[model samples]
Target: MVAYKSKVVERIRLPSRERRAAALEEAGYNAFNLAADDVFVDLLTDSGTGAMSDDQWAALFRGDEAYAGSSSFDQLTSAVADVMGFERLVPTHQGRGAENVLYGALLSEGDVALNNTHFDTTRAHVSNQGAEPVDCPIAGAHDPETDEPFKGNFSLERARAVVDEVGAERVPLVIQTVTNNSTAGQPVSVENTRRVRAFADEIDATFVIDACRFAENAYFVTRREDEFADATVADAAREQLGYADALVMSGKKDGLVNVGGFVATDDGALFERCKQRAILYEGFPTYGGMAGRDVAAMAVGLREAVEESYITDRIEQVRELGAMLEAVGLPVYEPVGGHAVYIDAGATFPDIPADEFPGQALVCELYREGGVRGVELGSFAFPETDRPELVRLAVPRRTYHREHFDHVAETAEAVLEKRHEVAGLEIVSNPAVPELRHFTASLEPVSAERAAAADGGSE
Candidate 1:
């Protein structure tokens, strides 16, 4: 791979440490509530936080601000068809909006929606529709230390069991999240996609893909998968997407855009159904929920996201950060993923009880220590699940350089060095509704004495 020169062209001022701490306290310990200016190194998510290229910015100016049949939408349609191999495009505001429309159209009450693993919003949307969201990920997916090449793959046995128990008729669709976020951002291999596609076909069920990180997933397939070892990233991506009957994308991610998403399919009937919902919930069929400028930016972003050099640089930055953390004796998920490094909070803070949310504690400490923001993928994120607590540091594409990652790693090391001083947090208030409570959950640090007692009592 060839190296490309880049430099930061924009700057923002950060708030004082005292202000940041007070902001965290006022926001109920939720990093999302902190002002953007207070964050020194924001790693909250890769979605919609990436820096667009000059070409994308240039396209934005060319946007035709029409409510119907916009030229910008035409560009997006062409790009989606060229890269994703989909025959129809149904745009939406973002990935979750696409999920809402697609699930609303296909799923009925009590229907089962199976996936390798359902990320937070996907699970919430399925559950909100009175449908069941079943995760069939390989057993290794839950083990942060597991070195499985494709930890995000759906287990064939588990998939079969779900079908047998739920009945084929009750299964609406099977989803495959590329670079499965819920499973440490691990990539689902081409073989796994083929297997799932075949199985879904056998059951006459739709095989849909959550393609938010499809570009990164494709890069992994080319580099890691034997069959695609010699293929280009674009070729690998096209082949991987070919296995899906339909796909939903968050343009904020792999599309390399600031904001946009779409649901694409080849089935005319399904497209019509999804289109109706898109119009009803999002906007007109042409622009969906995005403006013409956003559509134009997405068109250029989709093209750039598949570039070999771009993805190689992006994944390497994440790996560099993971190495930095691991060198400090932090327990990080092995076989570093495409977009982020996941810290095993359970292992790192073994004394911090799960119910108290060790992951949440770690997240807060990172912010307070260095104004660095990250997200927890632990019990708080999935209340009923027994998955190990994890803290994810998601790297935005083209937004930060190596220096920024080094700073974050240093902050993580600082936090780890003082791990014994940290105390877990407890929810003081929760959303009135049970679905997706983590977003608005009000949490406070557990009393220092109680935390000390729990630490002393733990093995």
Candidate 2:
């Protein structure tokens, strides 16, 4: 297959090894702490890290700077309605901001919010509101080697059981994270969404979608599901959205924008409530927390993201990288996800214990060896959940080319060759609040030997 032409037009210089080492120590061995100039390949996240297209850059110049009732907001609203099938739109700075507003409005003390799997911020928001976030992912999601097309799907039986246990009144929302971020970026099916919607209706629960990667999920549906084989990517996306009463999106992901998000719904009452909270937490209902320029770019991005050629190219790029790692006998999540490829860190480095943060150890080693930065999605990220320790390589949209991925694959192979030498990390300072410590927790090497192992055994 011929590859898509590379579009990168900018580059930055990487710092020296000494500088990189010092940065790591200062940041407590966290990749998020490393300076952008010190890294070569940064896969820390796809959020707000992608390169904007020529069209998006042009849109930025046409932005309306109005505090309220801007033309740019109108454009964004139309885009959301057309692309996502949502009748009402309330913008936010990002996905989490949308969650804070919507969940803050709907959830009460002791309410249960269920999902296939809650990403870090989603779970945090639910917990912050004194509500329980219950995960009901399909059985196949636990196994890295499983090839389930809809591995991110929530089990209907589990949802029913939860509803029965909690009673319909206590269950406020049932959310489905399309292309589940916590479970290897797996795509959920349209059929599964419909089932979940029906279940939600049965239990008098509100059906919401965490639709950060809705376009990618649509592409997967078109490719894998026979019923949607004849449908265009946009058609499949609309179908998926049709099942949800409301959705929260991080435009940073599928919208192909650097910054923007929204809470969109068809329910007028819920929309009013969410808009009220949006004004309190975010900005006005029209602008939410984003600038008029960001609104313009997101409008364009929403359209571009669902294009057949672009979606296909994006998924193919991720697949190519996954194949490279798997070819070299790396333990990656099977059937590579739409946005990232997950490395089974625990399986690869059996010598490192779970308590020692094996996934984070790999993250540090990758950066030290090749200046490549990735994130650990494991016990470190979700301490209470029984999730496998995984090192995620999230590809920024239109940021890197095939050669860049080739370099990343080679680096992983190099690190794995000496996997036995890799050591674990010990947290030095944790958050006093005890919520999402991986973001700000400070850690140190257990010993000098462990540090040396991460640094590729002395020079």
Candidate 3:
């Protein structure tokens, strides 16, 4: 039971989209110099990209002084290898360039990607590269009970079957850790990691890890599993990383700095292959398109990223907020993972069809009432949303405080109470329909000025 005293209220409600932009600053949310401070607690819409020190930000801006590809990048990439326990680690652009590099050799059309769950970008990258995604999270990885600290779902049998059907050459496997955001903050077990590695060897297929939530996953393993009671966060992380050939990371998630991401591999051949593409977009292997301090900060953050205290505190806070919502009879993701609390809009507002994109409307409601911001999990983050939509309230890397969580929760409860009053919208048409294929329409909130005008000069 998360206690909410009426004494604590939101600093203020950002009623208009334009004015909402000023809420953080107006509410004193911008006092922190670090971006991480802005995200980890804030339900604001940030992709956990980076949280750098003031000095690091200054260094990244001096792009001209940046060594395009420094030995420092190689050192950093090697550090990633050491942390992940892979023989090779490749750094690549997060954009189309990386996909192009993947096409001719590493990936093939009609091939399949088996992961615990999918992120829109990963799915888009894979599908566009000519493969479909297959997520095999441990049964109930998303459920509250019986799931392991590390929910390992890639059974040897499942791995073999996938490889047998797709051909080892075409079937690649991925394991996403921490909050299987798509599956609601489910953690994958380390033992499962060991097993999957064995399975990959058994089937002669490559294994990849989507490590966006790696730090949170490590924290869970240490806390929930008795077997790892003595393990440090870094040890658990290294243990899990050792199981895969390569891993993709979003700098926003684990990297301490902002605006960057990396791909790491253990295979020398694979490293060489991805290197060619890195130059096209991410720059040389040594620099990896990251500025000196950004890399320097990551080197520091990576060390800090595995700190048990930081990881535990961050995840526990999310669960606390989740418990609050669950107490209110609202549908939330069963398990709590780092950085988010998922609202099961479909269950909370069943009258709206899953395909109707109710998440779009709910987003508008939350934003209007409390200025609580979050992204839509339905069509917004996936291919289609409507019948069973999920609204993801992300607490980015560093964004809020204890009061902020309660503030967001209280606002959520208010919206739920009044959800019935919200009018449904009709889609007129989509312009960028191709890209829009996976995009759920932005509910497109009105600007403060526009909304005020519509309200007819009301204060």
Candidate 4:
């Protein structure tokens, strides 16, 4: 049992069916555009959506909002050192902020950065810096039903080929995202980490660990990897980090705080470069873009995230939800994942083509059917790329209980029953939008007549 109590509650209002339809139309069928109040169960993302503990709340009281050299920063650095074993910490507003600072400082025009898989924002940041981002996920990563213990493992063979093709000097960075978010929230093995680090060393490339759900990933390693079967999640995590020269973390996920992230490295010169860039784009070197209170809260959350009981509960809850989704006959990704259950939208709607965005349609129908929100992780998220059509139901940490998952399963079942009736969505927004168009892209049902049949459609 979790050794914590809920100190507060927020009432959730399930909007009427008519209101949901209206909200869908108003938001142009994009779940990201929906107002928080309009949705009943928000699964859009697990990022910064988790409930913090009383200790985290108490840490906020000790925040010292100094202009520079704040004690809160000191606390955050100490926590990062204790849990992550990194000597230097450069705080940022969030994960992407750290990415911008690190990538901006490290990458140059025409350079190449490789990863097991690059989440949307991570890819964008690399491209934005005029560099190329290459994904080398293991084979069958795109196959939703493929049973693999560590589906998140980076392909050493592919990495070697890329290094040979691009020439090692052109590839400056090699990263591995723990609990790889793009394909599925699958955990990476320590063995894979070790190999990737050795390969990076061979190519004289900087090996970085892109971690957000690091603790959850470590828990999975302990449960699945034989060598770690007797090891604590905390020790496994430290071992995983030991292989990386640096780490870019979104403290929002594992930190269990509402907002905060950081880049940790032992490379003093590289750390100095990131600090300079951080000051330009984010904030001061000490606090980054976050407040002292958030920094302090993140410090407590980092330690709490690796606790055996906390990690076990977190991963178990996600596993139970995945089983429930599978019980409803949903084609869920095999072995589940760390933070979310990904539904195979392609299998769910065989008739819906990739260009039409079947995943987005599923998310829209899910909201309309039961006021549940999910995000598409397919053609829409990674436009022009060949990837699995998936809709991710990301569960926030320590927030909802089994009853909430039951409701989500029921909602998914309801949508699946009338799956054929669901139509695909076409992007109607301006094509001039950024590469991450799913965030702001307006989309409409393909069949104008069918859309017009609704009370409020194609507005």
Prediction 4 TM-score vs. true: 0.96
Q: In terms of TM-score, how similar is model 1 to the real structure? A: 0.97
Give the clash count for each candidate.
Answer: 0, 0, 42, 0
TM-scores for every predicted model: 0.97, 0.95, 0.79, 0.96
C-alpha lDDT of residue 211 in model 1:
96
User: Model 2: clashing residue pairs?
Assistant: none
Residue range with the least summed lDDT across 10 consecutive positions in model 4: 450-459
lDDT of each: 0.89, 0.89, 0.60, 0.91
* lDDT of each residue in 1-459, candidate 2, tens digit only: 432454557775556667777878988988877778788999999998988888898999999979989999999999998999987999999989999988898898999999999988899999999999999988879799877888988888887888789798999899999999898999999999988999989888899999999999999999999999999999999999989989999999999998989999999999999999999999998899899999999999999999888888899989999999898878999889999999999998887778889999999988877788999999888887889999899999988988888878888888888899877899998885455888889898778766556558436
lDDT of 4 by residue, 241-359 (tens): 98988899999899999898999999999999999999998999999999999999999999999999898888888899999989998999988998999999989987677777999
lDDT of 2 at 114: 94
lDDT of 1 by residue, 243-352 (tens): 98889899999998888899999989999999999999999999999999999999999988888888888888889889988987889998899999999998888768
| Model 2 worst lDDT window (10 residues) | 1-10
Top lDDT hit = 4
**What lDDT is obtained when candidate 1 is compared to the true structure?**
0.89
Candidate 4, 203: how far from true, in Å?
0.8
